[model samples]
Target chain A: MQDDAKLIEFIKTDLARGKVTGKLGANDDLIETEILDSLGIMKLILFLENNYAVKISDEDLTLENFTSIMSINSLIQRKRAAQGA
Target chain B: MDFSFTDTQVLQRESIVEFARRELNDKVRENDQAGGFPLENWRKCADMGLLSLLTPEIYGGLGEDLVTTANSLEALSYGCEDSGLVHAIVTQLCCIVLINLYGSPAQKERYLPELSSGGMIAAQSITEPDAGSDVLSMRTRIEGDGAGWLLSGGKVFISNGPLADIIIVFARCGAGKSAFGEISCFLVEKTAAGYSMGKPLQKMGLRTLQNCEMFFDSVGVGEEMLLGKNGHGMFIFNEGIEWERALMTAAHLGTLERVLGKSISYVKTRKQFGKEIGKNQSLSNKIGTMKLNLELGKLILYKMAWLKDQGKRATLEASLGKLFVSESLKSACLDAIQIHGGYGYMQECDLERDLRDSVAATIYSGTSEMQRNIIARMLGI
Candidate 1:
């Protein structure tokens, strides 16, 4: 839940650039809504890697993994779990 | 954290510099003036094993790391007066690196040996008339035929387009407003039916490097020619650009060093008002800034190279480095010309040529404006 809020905030502030003034729901499609383009996705990955202390491989860069805040947070959680294991 | 080159790297740089000085500079001015591609020099570079610097040993390449590759390119740029030749070599190197990174075992076995050995030249065609920086907006379309894919589109401003026997062409393979899961890359041979190249387009600078327009009228490519997975072209293209931005600007380091050395020599020897011109504060300041920019550029570039060597994605660093190094090279070239005064303006002096060549540095790979946009986006601006 905390990761969800942080990811949503990042998308609103950094990726969406204030265009997303209203509440960004966890399930809202970042890609379909055009909030995150290709470059934005890369920047978001860097943020996730640095903030969460996890590495995102090229194979992990998929539309499914980055379509929404929930998806991104889930990806972060998965990477963290993998690291811990 | 260590910035110093290894002993082997140092020797490699020296040997490449020596080879470039000995063989690459001949008829450079004439070739640039004629807007001709120096095929002889290309063959010489291949023979010198420069073409194989980034490929794996199994594919006939030296498999040098990114830092060592950057060092060799820098040395080549420093020693060779022909910026066009250097640019062409870097283009080829980037293509080779891209294929090696993403090519399948079959793809690698088929293309890497010939490309690394300089038996065949390759071009990466992505830019279109409407889509230079906005690559996703490209109109190139690829449809899956019963047997293979049919590529139909045109690419402009393609380096080595005329000379490349194999071209990596990007086309939209899926329906999407976004580049994700839409773009795909194809390795189209020059012999492919309906594939044609226009005559080389004359350019303002880097004239020795050939630039041409490529047209495909339903060119057939086998399924085997697809690079990476379908819909992975955007990722592959971005990765290739990252590498290109980081490593291609290395040649500018050599050019900057050469321009700085020549400017300093001229200012110290040339007399004005009964004294050496370099003694003046204005002249000295300009040279000092050139030195400063050179050092700063080196720091940004070498750090980017080091980051890539550490297996880290350096998209941000690559943009920052490309922005700084390219703009600095342009400024240094202008300062070199100003320091040389009239002699610099003359074609015989070659400072003007460097200035002309420097303009394209800010435009190619990605423009200065594009680099700033990427940096700003990374900063969340």
Candidate 2:
């Protein structure tokens, strides 16, 4: 139920599916590979906010932060740290 | 689960229908023939707070929720014969919706009042000569210069482009890790240096609404004008397009009702073989299909509206609704023209004009093909 595990599970199950024809690694690019498109990006953002109780503001909406499972975990960690939780 | 409109919503819809019927129909044919923008009707809608349906109350808006706003737009499109004017209103409202969604406090304070009051018209500049549906492929570049930003690009087929007081320009600001992530939106004033608009582009339909080509030749804008963040333009566009696909075309539901009404009236009264056309199984079957399409379209749109009102992500719902309603509208118009036969082909009957306007429904706000692609992608195809 940790944030990182939850994110990976949701991304692989909900967004990736058969759209990602090739293997997806932890640091593989979701956007460049077209595994996660604009709508997928949105769904991921919504999922992160809803499940993790974090607000991904406009500034946080970036490829560097959302292009991979690793990057997404980094963003969540940074946000949680800022909240001093 | 509740399908009935509240008393207040019913009153609002009735008043809007009455106002549009009384004030928005004058010179519509002439305007269409000349391809003129209905500034008078635009101002009338502003005065009636139609322009402010989605804005916050602090910014002089009626602040209607998505469902109510969709209902009001449906009533307006039903009463108003000029589809172009309705098109223009929705385009302006789309710009307003983006501003409200992404604009900073100061930006909202600066623009929302004027936008809500109709003192300033707005356009969204995204499509380019090469980029129609592939928005991220746009070559419009935005580079930073420490103090401000430089924007240089040309946008084509921009609704409200010719007369807009301000425009939301989407441009590429960074290479990022992906092509889709580097785009950023800037609020550019029409009067800004090196900003110019081409002559209003004449079109096959929706002529009463102006579409134009715009150029931003290294136009400089302050940091204050950077909507959302520097590299969040794609997100802004995605959000805006989702709204447009869902709510902007809500009027088409009303257009379906209008088309069905006209068809029904024609079939009921226009006699052939000494009997009403509605009496024929073949002709009546077409009318039945139109009715079915209208009912289904309204249900989809209303459900989309309700979902939006509940603050849900509706990418799938929006694309489905847009595809269904737009394709259905085109078919209904064709059926209407067929029902009216020779009279429908004539300008006097106005069904031909309606048909022309309906064609653009599928083309704009993402084409039916694009909708299909979005849906297929969501399905993991």
Candidate 3:
């Protein structure tokens, strides 16, 4: 949960880019709500790879891993843990 | 940062060009006129190891890098007079690269050796009656069976459909989700029951490359045949298309170079008003523009290839390169024909054929409009 706020801020600021109204929840369905398109997903992957230094392979590109800010945060934390181990 | 080819790469390119010229150019006119796929020429390309350029050595391939593979494709297109043949070869290469990238270990062990050696042909079937640019709208359906899947749908405009021994078919696996999670692909063999192919479709250009419609009626495929994970078809497709858009247009680079060379030679030798036509500023300017486009096109293509070789993403670069090279190649082809005058219109002159073939470049591997949309999206517009 350390990076949840950072992940949410990045999605709202960088990806949504003022498209979201009021507040974007951490558990909001990114795909179902159309907040993150295919290109947005690609950009998110690039951001996680560059900012977090966690390499995401094709297998990690599932809908479950990218469904929400919380899910994405979990993915990054898991990748970081794996790297540290 | 260094852009020069290595000594070995330079020699390898030369040998490939020479081999293509000797073996692939035979009866090209006849083959194109008949709209026939040249099986003999395909076998020659396989024997020359052209088919195995990018497959890893573990799978009976040369294990060449992306730059080398692009270089060889450029050389092959330059020396071969048959644009259709070059297109077919590039299509196979795209499928091979896709399988290499996403195939399971068991799938690789079963398919790579034969595909790499050109002992079998493969096609990627994604387009449907209603789906061309809008892939998410495709209606092909795959339903889960006991331990397998039942595929039922039809695909149109499949490049190697007529002759492919195995086809990678994308189908809808679920509903009420985004394209990223709704689509799945399966590897279906030609011998599968209830699978059938329509006759080759007639086309104005690239006539020798056969394109056809395919149908699958409850064709059963084991779960093992599913490529990658379920719901990952769109991702797999996007990844594979980057390679296709980049390297397939590498062949267009060769076509552009050949057209520029021919235009230059004709202008220098052909006389108009008692002087060489090269003396005409208007005509010379066209040739000059052709040269400029070819050079710029090469730079974009190589940059994309270099990005892929470095294990970096090149989605935007690939779209930009595809758009630029495809449009410029069409312009170059037309200029070559115009510069050649009446003689160029003749089928024997071959510039007309090049022009006909160039039209498809803008239309396939994602259209020019789609490329622009991708570029805009990448720019966050």
Candidate 4:
């Protein structure tokens, strides 16, 4: 599995109970697919912050930044670059 | 555990108490009877900087932490006889705080300064007719437009609805999203073409605060109006509820003190059977219980507020605090009325209105039953 897949798996396992309910695709929108309800999204945000050591600021909380696993991974990469990680 | 307030907090509390006592209590009985919200008092509170306690200083706010906000609200409630007006203030302030936390920079630029300065009133639109406690079951929908969204639905029991300039409306979206998944929060201005408000709904208590039903019939909102990202309504709404439950009832803490003081004074002075009512054990025991509830409720509320200030999620603590303080306020009001005997029931004593207002504490920001459900879930029950 790819590194991005690992994060997707984490979200899937915690929020969707490891079930691929057609909403866990790599490019599927977590908010749009209903896989991550509001509370689930919050939990996922915390999960990414804690596991990856990246801060998700309010400006980064938009749909363009968090729509899918790909977007989330890209955001993390950008944040890491910004921090010179 | 240290429960001491900082000197700054103490001074803030004192000034708020003084202001409320001097400016807010006038003609309260007449206003309550007329169901009139005194706009002057609302602006007075704004001028005192009470309107902007939680927003950042750059946005024209006092930017106080949660504990200080709670302390100031408690002092205001203690001094102010107008609980309805305070209720309106909390509703508007809660909306402002949520917007500050979630609004885009542009959205903030448009609304925050006016909201913080009390030049504009804010209200949150939730609690539909079929979806009060079952918030996820709301039927309001937001369909994607070319560069915006079209909202169509109705919201009931909207606090400050009639007077609000901007309303944070929650609506459904997404094709196959779960009930919770499809919801999104939108910023709907009252001037929107299809947006309209019903007349204020008269109530038994908090009469001076205006509440109404709102309708959005294909109201168009640009991308700038979304408070947070789409499908994140519940999270944003939850944030507000958490703060509201944790701190808004700080006023009730003050109300409890007021009721207790009044009861004590009445018991000490009023003579019955050739002696003061304090000579009676039952009445004195009632007072004792009121005191007990006051102390315990304060500790819970203070802890919850402090946790919020530390930027921690205190869902359990907030629920517990809201549950305790609201119920305690009701009981204290009842005891005060009982202690005052027939006179308490009369509008002249104000205990009747206090009791009426205290009853609503169990209903909004999640009912007592819902709070217990949250607590039980947190306990993994």
Candidate 5:
């Protein structure tokens, strides 16, 4: 499975789960746009934790960390590589 | 924004509902009739750490955030029959959350453990016979006596008044001060001298939790009892109220769902005009409206909770949630009563109790009118 494809799918599913609609863009404000409010982030964190097998510490959970599909995918790759995955 | 709870949240919700069902329900009618507080149920809830839903574990609380707390309360309301019992729990939780957020370390050390462990029942006393919704109009005052503060005032419509060991009292200080900025909240213990309760009020609903009046005449407390800054207590009060208004009726969303399901079953099974009442367009439409309200109410409240969990100031969202759910539940309860017909009018089978409980919702924690004011103000209307 391509990581980018899967990440896009995850984001789409999350968007649907929240019943929020908009054109996917790299710069959408997740919270300001009402896309991924508090619970959505928690759910996303849980999803990433399970699927990526990456332990996301409290400090790492930030808007900076998950603002875009590229950001999340890059962070996942970095973490997985650091873990020698 | 997401209506579905996460795994832990779902479990928390289930556990609270189970705890309420196992510990409460059967005794609700008797307690409601007698206007008595549910001491044993209070203990049971505390043992389950139900009271600490909002408090952090650092202060001997569960330390969960707003979403988990909302889920727990929703389940508790769903499984529990006595709105009075649930109201008392909500009142205590509201007060304790403020204590955890703003109280001194000594205050937390003393009260959080006691409250979370069910060592004592708690109350939030701010409504006075005169104060009502215009909080600044409070006649209660805390005089800065040479040896601690002397409290002289009375509060009415206080939930859990008869049972609280420590009641959080909001008072207006500096009589000439600005209307919105000079309020203070104090943690007054029930055992304090000159602190007494009047006969519990016969409430329109939620009677099992012991709604009543309390008088604080020369009630004294040390400097340490002040929660937050003296003049900034309105901040703490409003914070508690925001959380209360947002999450308190969450369980009622589930209650709405339950009532809708009940109504559907009634209309489906019971023969009316030689057919199921649900087959009639009017009855189905009523249930449909109820279902719509229930789903939308849940979405709004959960969104508010999500906002809180993200460190966002969700004042507007919370007000919106409160407005929608409180008004929506009114619709649900009225429909439930209609579906049950004469049986709903009777004192049997919890529809009456549910109706009574819903009546109190539009009034407490900021009335529906007040909620609209907040929402409109937020909208700059």
Candidate 6:
């Protein structure tokens, strides 16, 4: 969970820098509201895949796992936990 | 605040830069001189994911987002020497993104995988001699046939026309209706009996891109060929135009930055009147303006990307961005050329190429005039 928080911070860091948003005010559905496009989503995927020790196949990047901040946070958490990170 | 790349996006840009510098920088001049497409490097681009960034993964595409694709194109543009190849990639992506977003599943199953992998190149045919900026004014039409529709029309100035594996075409589906409501786009294979491509046409810029005239004489297409709906071609095409016009010139923005960087390096080193040209205010302002355009253009593109991601309509924003960047690039290229002095005018330095290439930014993806028209209408003109 701490790792997930870190990932969220990292993403928020990107958002802040990109001037996308200040802090991702809501925890859920940030992605679906057009806060991030597929490119931003892919960038998030690469970060998670490398840093959080998750294997993000093409299927995992869909709306199901990535539609919201909460879902993305959960996905990061689950993947890290599974990887024993 | 922090509108730049994450570490991965940075690496993506770097990798493409390396590939382009290693493969494209030197060959661009030769290919342009020869008036030939660089077939070898094109496939290399496909292998590297330039072609399939948007097709959904189920169909074997990397299915990258608009942001990733935009960044990648910019990086590639900065490193590579060929604007024509970049334009060709744009044409392919434009057509393919439309198909993936709106084409039927069967269409997806049949085409996306090959397109992503570069086994097929697609062309979009919408412009006509009489219908340049006004897209719906074209006279092409599709009437009902036995099990499919027989399309008959011609599209001119089609990018990637001579080399396309599948051509996405728009034709009128009903008479005496709003052109917007009467036209539909379709997917037709190169091998389709009645679909024929003309010889590649000479272009003032984008010379290596295979822009050509195309003919569709009773080209028969199945019911599955209908993209989106019978009359939704306009909708699907409009959906991506903002990004296409506004942000797709990301590479051009990058080119301005690259040119500015080159000028900075040269001015500091090259002695002019027995002193570095960096000592001049005029030269410094030239680079400053280039830098200004780069940063401003990026912000505009970033806003469009953000807006599109948010499910917001960005037509007005897009037109403004397109208008600003397209005109800025032409001006930047001219300024860059001026800074290079005699060398810039000569073919030896890359500045002349930049100047020639920047000429088309106002023409393609809808002319700058058209963008103004769109913007004016949005402003209630």
lDDT of 2 by residue, B1-381 (tens): 689999999999899999988999878788889998889889999999988998999999988898999999999999898998888788888888899999999999999989988999999999999988776678899987558988998999999999899899999887544545578899999889999999999899899989999998989989999888777788889888877876656888888889999999888998889999899988899999989988898888888888778876677788899999989989999998998898888898888888899999999988899989888866645
Q: For residues A1-85, write the lDDT of model 6, one tens digit per residue.
A: 5765666676666533454454554365654354453224434554666576677643353455665567787787777787787
Residues B166-218, model 4: lDDT tens digits: 99998887645443346789898889999999999999899999999999999
Q: Which is superior by DockQ, 2 or 4?
A: 2
Task: Supply candidate 2's per-residue lDDT for B7.
Answer: 99
How would you class the docking of model 5?
incorrect
Worst window of 10 by summed lDDT in candidate 1 chain B: B173-182
Clashing pairs in 4: none
Model 3 chain B poorest ten-residue lDDT run: B174-183
Give the interface-residue alpha carbon RMSD of model 3: 2.2
Per-residue lDDT of B298 in model 2: 84
- Assess each prediction's global lDDT (C-alpha) against the native: 0.88, 0.85, 0.88, 0.85, 0.76, 0.75
Q: What is the DockQ of each candidate?
A: 0.62, 0.35, 0.45, 0.18, 0.02, 0.02
Measured against the true chain A, the candidates' chain A TM-scores are 0.91, 0.86, 0.89, 0.84, 0.76, 0.68
lDDT, candidate 1, B116-148, per-residue tens: 888899999999999987878889999985378
The list of candidate 1 runs beyond 4 A from truth reads B145-147
Q: What is the lDDT of residue B46 in candidate 5?
A: 80
Q: After aligning candidate 1 to the native by TM-score, how far in Å is the CA of A85 from where it should be?
A: 4.2
Return the top candidate by DockQ. 1
lDDT by residue (B1-381, candidate 6, tens digit) is: 678778888999999999998987767877887779888888999988888877778888886777777788888888887988988887778777777777778888888888888888888888888887665577888889437899998889988889988888888776532322466778888898898878899877778888899998898888888777776565556665655774456767767777777888878987879999978998988888888888898888778766666555577677777778878888988987888899888888878877788888888887888888776644433
What TM-score is obtained for chain B in each of the predicted models? Answer: 0.98, 0.98, 0.98, 0.97, 0.94, 0.96
lDDT of 5 by residue, A1-85 (tens): 3876666666666543444465565555455554454234544565677788886653465456676776788788888998999
TM-score of 4: 0.85
Clashing pairs in 1: none
Residue pairs that clash (backbone atoms under 3 angstroms), model 2 = none
